[model samples]
Target chain A: MRLALLAAAFCALAVPALAQTSRPEPGPLTIAKQGSFFIGGREVKSDTLSTLPNFDAAGTITVDQMYVRYQAPAGQTGVPITLIHGCCLTGKTWETTPDGRMGWDEYFLRQGHPVYVIDQVWRGRSATDPSTINAVRTGKKPVDQLPTVFSAGHEGAWAIFRFGHQYPQVLPGMRFPLAAQAEFWKQMVADSAANLPTPNPTVPALSELAQKIGGTVLMSHSQSGIYPFQTAALSTQGVAGIISIEPAACPDPTADLGPYKAVPILVLFGDYVDEFPRWAPRLKSCRAFAAAVSAAGGKAEVLALPEIGIKGNSHMLMQDDNSLYIADILLRWIGKNVTATR
Target chain B: MRLALLAAAFCALAVPALAQTSRPEPGPLTIAKQGSFFIGGREVKSDTLSTLPNFDAAGTITVDQMYVRYQAPAGQTGVPITLIHGCCLTGKTWETTPDGRMGWDEYFLRQGHPVYVIDQVWRGRSATDPSTINAVRTGKKPVDQLPTVFSAGHEGAWAIFRFGHQYPQVLPGMRFPLAAQAEFWKQMVADSAANLPTPNPTVPALSELAQKIGGTVLMSHSQSGIYPFQTAALSTQGVAGIISIEPAACPDPTADLGPYKAVPILVLFGDYVDEFPRWAPRLKSCRAFAAAVSAAGGKAEVLALPEIGIKGNSHMLMQDDNSLYIADILLRWIGKNVTATR
Candidate 1:
């Protein structure tokens, strides 16, 4: 009877073996320093600055407010990395991944690199003002088009990304780590459609962030890929290196990238380009931009996974099943070109 | 010394242990039918059949050949299943995943279903004459188009699948067995581009294969989705049921689906649909087709994983990490609708 009771207890305990999603016992991680910075502020006499309804007041107005979250291991890799997420997403992109796995934020920290993740002005914790952001030269009675934000559902993504041969037709070799897709979809935020054109505020704010944390490596994803490129050009000495993962857009074709000559850059592209027709032109532009950078004596290396014999990777390489494998590659490259060399 | 040699031998045997990629020890599996069949033959006159240096000699010519590999467990389910792969792929799609994991072929076999995997006529072992296939009148010069076939490279897929947010970006929850990518890529074949507009010979050949193996459930993927639909229309009594995974196109919208009224059908869609723009219309069409089937009194169930609370599945649910999970659902549905009800 005792033995039966013991077996029953064991069975009860083992039946629902839920995967533990919590972090391990606290590691030697310390919050070095974290704060907020304001950029693009101009002193102006505003007619409606007061909290009171449309009351006139004079004060300084800031265009954007930037929030920074920095963490470092006890033993740091002298070279720090500042992670910048794409539009809509916040610093959370670098934190835990959708499927509850350690994200690049934690991965980099464990690798002994001081990590700094930031929410660009008017995003996430930085907050936003819809009226100010959507203000346009409309008419006598101004109308605020709160920036028609759009968010993709599952079907839209499956087709555009070529997750499978096409929607519903998953290929045999796709490696997107799809098990955590629900958690991933949660990360999708409504991005401003208006911001597709320019980078006036975001580029300057991020450049300032880089300058503030001098000698930092800039890692950017998707739409924010241009941040590091523009940042490197604006704050030349502040950035040690740049790693761009499928930048939504490319560096200017006409502009001289000479300032980035001394800075090393790695542009990584994953699988399923031919299936999505839109990617062809974007990739071509990126390739051309990289080629121009090389011509300007800049050490820019474009790593298209297929060309390198690596197959079945999607756009989200960081959260992939072989994420650690790719992360190791990035770390090795960083150690060789930035950390060790420095 | 003798003891040391014994220990050394044991260590050598165990030190570099590798996962067994080979088939498991022989189970109670029996080969029901394994052979080739030729269809569509035309006999030429003796004068035309004689071959000379300058003149063409023609004998009896067969346009299509079909190969079938069938296996059943000792105690087989009365219902058998015929597995067909998508474009540029073969029956291997159901055999093993790109990451060296067991595919539905093995999964269903273990579950006691007699499995029939086929190389659609002209693909894989069912070889066809390219010259004969390309002879169709497409343009002015009778130039052999030979189909402008394309196989998506690694990077192309990474972005399109919403695997990571873009190419090379793997998410945290991706269940794709990525380690076996090399083996997976080997299975990719160049499909016939000319067949896009019409099912023609391929569908007929598949239908014949289904007919040859009576009372078989037809499971089709990608380009092959159309085959089972058309096959059911042609070989109505032969196919007991149909399972379509992201069919490239659906049955003719204009045609009456009354033939499939008695047939049970299940259509499954995976994750990241929002990322792919083309999927919207395609999926809309598929949904419409499935709706039509149901309205016509057919038992058609359309499963969008996310809508059903099963998330992060790419197009390739069979080869996914959670493949078994989806398989279980399919089996349950199969049992409840086909096996049990019957």
Candidate 2:
């Protein structure tokens, strides 16, 4: 009966339409009977990663599009997990160092988890990647890829003082520090050299990818974790649990995190980082935020940072001196925390 | 022309496979058009938790799925970050206990990461949920799920004596003690209930789930993190990064843990956990395994337990004291390390 219905539907619409990433809504639409994708003369073997992108182009984006890989046990199939990098960072940082394979990447690899490293717009390898902002500057390397503000009247102190650079862009409020931009570029080159993919909202792109990987979990560091939080909150079928490491920025829920459903979430960190005086406010903010997640029924907790002297105060817990200590907390969190309860 | 093609394809096939995770593979006789999944569906969409075993199963099994209710955002996009609970505790412990939320979930949720929670197998609300492992047991609660034994006949005093669990059959060699299984279960169920999932190769199931989540990261703790390791090592596709904290067991890679691909990985623990006298060999083995992964171009790291007494020996880092410290470390690592490099 199923086959007959499909065949009839096919026969009714003898011709198909040409579409790509963008689409428009029409009256009385039937997604079920809509044209399915097929490459070449033969029918598409599967929604293989290669073919799925074309699908995302067919309509609006979906949460299932992201392609994080997963392998399952007999009764326990795994879902996909995503790794979003922080500001100016590529996704690969979640794995190894710039040289090749490092400690953390190897840990995940050994444990058997996939890592999707993406460069956010204007950072890392993505310095040249395309986005709504960069679409206009569509030229070659740095020149075309650099933010428009750089060329405009927003030249930084370094640019103005050093090379006699001038920001006569004739626009107000566009100026930013050249140091900040330089910092951004530095992170990008490192990530790019190491083959890390830049993180982007690229939700539509992910929807196609999701079909390829079994399930996905969003893992973000610094600013990237924010991507997953936003992703999950926006769609009905978004990411699963998130392993956020000093992820900056997230929206608070009016209701609470509980309704993201009963996701098996685990929020962890090093004590040394939290105790540092420099990050007290951030710590307070983080704690209050995590508390909200917990109040709504999701699991959230912060680990204490090492003593100030034990590991340098540094910018964050995982960074600076006691690097290994931070890794331990994250690895352990993944090992013991995330799982399906009876 | 595109519309024509779609009409032609649609006319031939009706009732398009709605929400099919993947298309079935054609017979071998059929030539493959696309080369492979490389460079196709690549997105940062980490997903977690699902009732259905595979991604392709268009039918979603709500029994085991997390039920989420999206709420308005207190801030930006309303995309909140939630946390999932592990083996023994409730979400409440994380936010309002002697410690605090540490901003683990709420931090991101507030910045846009809404916290979510999950009950472990045979523990908390999950135990009562008929769809989860709780249904497999045989008792008023009917203990359904069981643990995965890498060692065949490795029994301990707990299995045979303390909990007094009788096995249908033990593996070939390696017996701990008659009390092995019994004691292990007893310890597992201290605050939580005793339950574990049956062990299997796990590759296929995990792969299927990954496809659904669009491939996300798995941030786990204790024994559960092992599953992520297993999945990442053998996944058909690459997974994102995996964060494990205080894993119950670090199986020797030589014993398993397949390829060193996917994304980045981090394995960590407190100095005490690293010094865990009982499993020195395992920890050593983990280090060696991580080293091996690093050599293979995967990032892997080992973080020993916290040195200072502030955060002492404890299985659950996020749950106990020093929660804030731990959260900071996570934020730092993800931002600095993972983002800095691949």
**Candidate whose TM-score is highest:** 1
In the range B106-220, model 2's lDDT, one tens digit per residue, is: 3333332223332332222211112222122212222212121111111221121111232334222212222322212211211212223343222233444444444334455
Please give the range of 10 consecutive residues that has the lowest summed lDDT in model 2 chain B: B31-40
TM match of model 1 to true structure: 0.43
| lDDT for A216 (candidate 1) | 80
Interface RMSD over true interface Cα atoms for each candidate: 28.4, 28.1
Query: What is candidate 1's lDDT per residue for B221-278, written digit by digit as tens?
Result: 8667777888777767677788888777777655878767778888777776656674
What's the lDDT for all of these models? 0.58, 0.34
- Estimate the TM-score for candidate 2: 0.31
In the order shown, the candidates' DockQ scores are 0.01, 0.01
* Number of backbone collisions per candidate: 63, 266
- Residue B266 of model 1: what lDDT? 82
Question: In candidate 1 chain A, where is summed lDDT lowest over 10 consecutive residues?
Answer: A132-141
